[model samples]
Target: MISSKEIKRKPDQDASKHYDSVIDKVLQKLDTVCKEVIDRTNQNNQQENEEARFGQQVKQKPMNEERKEKEENALLLQLAEKDKGRLHLFIKLVDYMTVETLVSINQTSMSMLLEEMKKERKNGLFNTAVNFDVQIFTPDEKEISEHLKCLLDDMIVVMRNTARVISHQSMIGYIKNTKLGELLSEQKENKDCIADVQGIITDSIEYQNIKNEIFEKVTSDFQAAEVYVNTNYMRCKPIYEFLNTWNQGDFENKEHTLDIIKSHVMELKKWLADINFYIKDIAKGILNVDGKKIKNKLQPQVVTKLENFKDYLYKLMQKKANQTLTTLQTYTSNLSKNPQNLKEYAEFIEAIQEAEQNIKGLETAKIEVEAMHSLLKSKFDLNPLKNSDIVMMDDIQAEYLRLTLKIKEAEELCKERKQEMMKKHEAEFIKFITNIQNTTSSVNKGKLILEETQPADALQQLNEIKTRSLDRFKELDKNYQHYAKLMGLSVTTNKDLQELEATYNDRRMLWTHSDKFNKLYEDLQKNIFTTLNVEEIEKEMKSYEIGILKLRQNINNLSKEGRDKVLDQHANRVGNVSQFMPVIQALGNKDLRPRHWKKIFEDLGSAWQPGKTFTLQELIADGVMNKKDKIEEISAKASGEASIEAQIEDIKSKWSQLSFIVNHYREAKDKFIIGSLDDIIAALDDHQLKVQTKLGTRFVAEIRPSC
Candidate 1:
C-alpha cells in the first residue's frame, strides 16, 4: 500500500536514523568516560581520607617516641636557656599551615575560577550574561583576611585539641612513673576516689574525650569553608558556556536591541571590574599575578556589541531616509503636471511644504548620525537604504510660492467668471437698456458693472449703442439744416455738425460723458418728429436772437461800470499813469473795452484834479491805493520840492529798516553783471530744406546754466 515516493524516502529515512543512532552512541560513550573519571576521582578522595586518618593516629603517639625526638629535646634545652621564650613551636606551625598555606590555596583556586569566568564572557557564554553576575571569587584584603582568620581559628581549635591530648599523655606518664601514677591506677578500682592522682588522671581522660569532640567540630568547619570556596566554579561554568555560543550577528532590530546589549555589556564590565579589584587588592600576593590579563579577553566582546548596535542604527536611519526620499520624489513627479485649478494648486503647495519639512527632518537626522560616526559619512552614500541629500528643498519652496500665486490667479479668474455668470449677457443688457425710462442713469450703472465684471464685451456693446444714437442725431441735424435754409438763415453745415458729434461719440466708450451719451440716445428715442419744421425753426431762431441780445446788453453794462472806475482813478489821482499800465494788463484784452481806455485819457486833461491834498495814509484810507503804491508815487515825484520834503521826513523815520534791503539789492545788481549773466544763451537750431524748393529756417533762444 506504500506509495513510490514513501518507498524511495524509506531508505533515506533509514540512513538518517542510522546517523542519529551513531551520534547517540558517541554521546553515550563520552558520558561513560566522564562517569569513569568521576569514579576515579572519588576513589582518590577515599584514599586521601584513609591516609589522613592514619596520619592522625601516628601524630597521637608520645612525642619522644616520634621520629623527631632528638630535635625536640634540643629545642627544649634551647628554650630553657632563654630569658624570654613566649613563641611556641606548635603555634608557629599552626600559623604557617592554617593561615598562610590555606590563604594561598584559596587565592590560587579563586584566580583560576575568575580566569574561566572572563573566558566565558568573551565568548558570550550565557543567555543573560549581561544581567548575570559571576560568583564572588577572591575578595578584598579585609574579607580574605577574615576568611583566613575564621579558617585559622577552626584549625587552632584542632591544634589546641591535639595539644590537650599531648598534655594528657604527658601528665599520665608523669603520674604512672611516681606514686601518683600508682595511686591513679589503684583509684580506678573505686567509682568515687578522693585521691589527687586518681581524680587528676580521671579528669585528664575526660578532657581527652572533649578534645576528640573539638576535633570533630573543626573538621565540619573545614568542610563548610571548602564548600564556600568551591561555589565559584559551579556558578561560573554556565556563563562560560553561554558566551561561547553567543553571536552578535544573530540579533535583529539592532537600533532597539542595542540598548539591551549595551546595558548587558556595562553589567559585564562591572563584573570584570569587581574581579579585577579582588585580584589586585587581595589575590595578588596569593596568586603571584594581577587579574589584568582577563580585561583583554572581555573588552573585544563589548566592542563587538557596540559595533553591532551602530550597524542597526545605521540601517534604521537609512530606511527612514529612503522612505522620505521616495515621498519627496513622488510629490515632485505629481507637481510636474501643473495644477489646473485653484484647489489643485493649493494641494500642490501643501505637498511642496510637506516635502520641504521632510527634507529638513532628514537633514537633522543626518547631522545627528554624523555626530555619532564621522567615518561613516562616505559609507552612508553607499548604503542601499541610504538616500542622497534632498537637494530639491529650495526648488520645493520656489514651487510652493509659484503654486500659491497660481492659485490666487485662478481664484481671481473664477471670481470674475462667476460675476459674469450672475449678470446679464450683452444682448440681454441691451434689452434692459431699451426698457429703461431713465436710460442715462440705467446705462451708467450697467456700464460700471460691466467694466468691473466683463470690461471688454461691455464696452463694445456700449459703443454700438452710441453709434446708433449718433446716426439718429445726424438725421435730426439734417432736418434742422433744411428748416434753416427755408427760413433764409445761414445754417450750420451737416458735415461740420457730424464731425463735432463724431468727436463726442469717439469718447462714448469712456467712463466720462457716458451718462450724457445715454441721455442723448433717450432724447432721440422720445422725439417723434426727426426734423425741426419751418415754424419750429423760426421759433428756435427767435429764441437764439433773444439770448444773443441779452448777452451783449450784459457786456455793455459791465463795460460802462468798468470805464467809470478808470476815469475816476485817472482824473482824481495826480500821479504817473505808468503804475496803471499793470492794471490794464491785468484786465486782459478779452475783458477790457476800447472805450474804457479812451475815457481814461480824456479825463486826464482838464479834469486832472489835485483831489484834496492827502497824505499817504489818507490815500490808503480812501482805498485808492495801498501804502506801498503811495510810497512809490512819492519816490517818482522826488524832483519836486514838496515830494523832496515828504521823502526826507519818510526816509528819516524808516531809514534803519530799509537800508539793509536797499544795499542787498544794489550789491546783487553789481554782482549780476560781473557773472556775465545776460551773455549765456541757448538756441534751438532747426532748418528745413528741399532741393530746388522753398525752405525756411527758424531759431528760438533759451538760457541754460551748467554747474
Candidate 2:
C-alpha cells in the first residue's frame, strides 16, 4: 500500500491464481454431473429391454393356448359331424334291410287277388265289403337264406364300425369312461344273435328245413336286435344330455361351437327316437306268437296259404284306404260343381265313416306294408280329402249353414226373375204402342200397369193390345170401301188428294234448288225497297206461291171431305158416327205419328218461300211442271165414270188392308228382341256355356274313381 505500482502488480498476480483455481473447480463439477447422466440413461435402456422380453413371453403363451384350443374344438366338431352322418346312414340301411325281408316273401297270390279286385271295380261289380281268401304266402327259402346271410353280414359290419366310432378315438372323449365298455357288452350279444341266425340260414340246404330254421332264427335275431336297439336308445338319452351340456359350454374362445354341437345333438336325438320306435315295432312283429304257432302247426303249403291270406288282408286295407280317398275326392269335386246339392257332400261324409269302420283294426306286421299304411293314413289326414267323423259332422253343420245361404240366394233369384218378366212385359207394351201408332189403327194404347200389375197380367195386356191393334187394321178395309162408295165421284177423293199434295209439295221443294228461281230470288231480295225492275221474277214467284197455296188448300179440302165421307159411311154402317169419332181421331194422327214427319213438313214449308236460293240441277231433277201434270192426271181421273172409280177404290182399299196386316204380323213375331232384358239375356247365354264347362269338369273328375 506504500508503493502504488508494486502493490498493483502483486494484486494482479493473486487475482490470476485465484481465477485458475475457480475454473478447475468448475470443470470437476461438470465431469461429475455428465458421468451421473450417462449411468441413468444406461439403467433405463436395460430395464426397458427386460420388460419387452417378459411381455413377449406372456403374449406368446396365451396365443399358443388359444390356437391349441381352436384346433381341439375344430377336431371335436368334425368327429361329431361324421358320427351323426354315420348314424343316419345306419338307420336308413336298417330300414332297407327290414323292407327287403318283407319283399322277399311270395306275393303272386296276393297280386292275383288284387288284379281280380281291380277287374271287378272296372266292371262295376266291386262291392265295398266283398271278401276273398287267398292262397298262403311264404318267402323263397333259397333266396331268403342267401338274403339273411348277406343281411347278417352287413349288420355285423355296421355294429363293429359303430363300436369303433363310439370308442375314445372317435367320440370326442365322451365315451372314454365305462360307457364304451357297456356298449361293447351289448354289441357282443347282438353279434351273437346275428351270427346264430346267419349260421342256421347257411346250414339248411332243403326248402322245408330252411323255412323252419330261417324263420325261427330270424325271429330270435330280430328280438335280440330290438333289445340291443332299445338299450342303445336309452344310452342315447344320456349321451345326448351330456352332448347338449357340453355343446352349450364355452371352450377356448371358439365361436359357434355350442350351436354346431347342439344341431348334431338334436339330429341324433331324433334319429334315436325314430330308431327306438322302429325297433319296438320290429320286436312286436317278430313276437307274433299266433302267426308262429299257426306256421308251426300247418304243413308248408298251408303255411304259404296263410301268408298269402295275410298279404291279401294287408292289400285289401291299403286299397280300401286309397279307394276311400278317391271316392271322397270325387264327392268333393261334385260338390264344387253343384254346391247347391247336399247329396254329394253327404255321401262324402258317409264314406269317411265307412272307411273308419272298415279299416279300424287292419294292420300289417311287415315293415314294407307299414310304409304303405303310413301313406294310407296321410291320404285321409292330408289336405282336400282330410276328414274325421268329428270333422265330417262339423262340415255337415257348415253345409247346413250354406243351405240357409242358398235359400236366401234362391229367393233373391226368384225376385230377380219376377222383376225381369215385368220389365219384359212393359217393354212389349211400349212396342205394342209403337206398332199401333205406326198402323192405321183406330185405337192406340201403351199405358201399362207396370208397377201395379203382375208379370202374367202385364203380358196379357200386351197380348190384348197386339190383338186389338191387328183387329183395327182389318176394320180399316171396311172403312176405306165405305168411304169410296160415299164419295160417289169419278175420282177416288182420298187417293187423288194424296197424289195432288205430294206433287205440289215436291214442285215447291224444287224451286229452292232451281238456278233460275235462285237468281231471280237473289235479284228480288237485292231490289227490295229499290227501283230495280224485278217484276218478271216477282211475277214468277207470285205464280209459284199462289199455285202452291191453291194446291195445298185443295188437298186439305179434299182430305176433310174424304174423312167426312168415311165418318158418314161409318155412321151408316154402325148407326152412329160419334162413337167412331174417338176411334177415327186416334187413327186421325197417323201421318203425324212418325217422329221425322213434323221436321220434314217444316223444312219443306220453310224452303218454298220467296227469295230462297237454289242449285240448277235440282230443278230439272225434280220436274218443273210436276204439279201441273199431276193436276191434269187428276182431272182426267175425275172425268171417268163413277162406277169405274168405285171399282178402283175397292181394289185399292183391299190391297192396303192386306199390306197393313202383313206388316203387323212381322212386327209382333220379333218381340223377344225388343222386350227381353239385355243383361238377363246375355247372362242366359253365358250360363249355358258355364254349364257346359261344369259338365266337362264332371266328366274329367269321374276318371279318378275308375282308377
- State which candidate has the highest lDDT: 1
Top of the candidates by TM-score: 1
The 10 consecutive residues of candidate 1 with the worst lDDT sum are 698-707
- For every model shown, the clashing-pair count is 9, 7
- Candidate 1: misplaced stretches above 4 Å? 1-177, 182-301, 353-707
Residue pairs in candidate 2 whose N, alpha carbon or C atoms collide under 3 angstroms: 136-304, 136-305, 136-306, 136-308, 137-304, 137-307, 137-308
Tell me the lDDT of candidate 2: 0.37
Per-model C-alpha RMSD:
33.9, 42.9
Our tally of clashes for model 1 stands at 9
lDDT of 2 by residue, 167-212 (tens): 2222222232344345545765676312232333234353234344
Q: Report the lDDT tens digits of candidate 1 across residue range 328-373.
A: 4565555454544433444554554555555556455444534333
Which pairs in model 1 have colliding backbones?
120-240, 123-243, 124-242, 124-243, 125-242, 125-243, 126-242, 126-243, 175-181
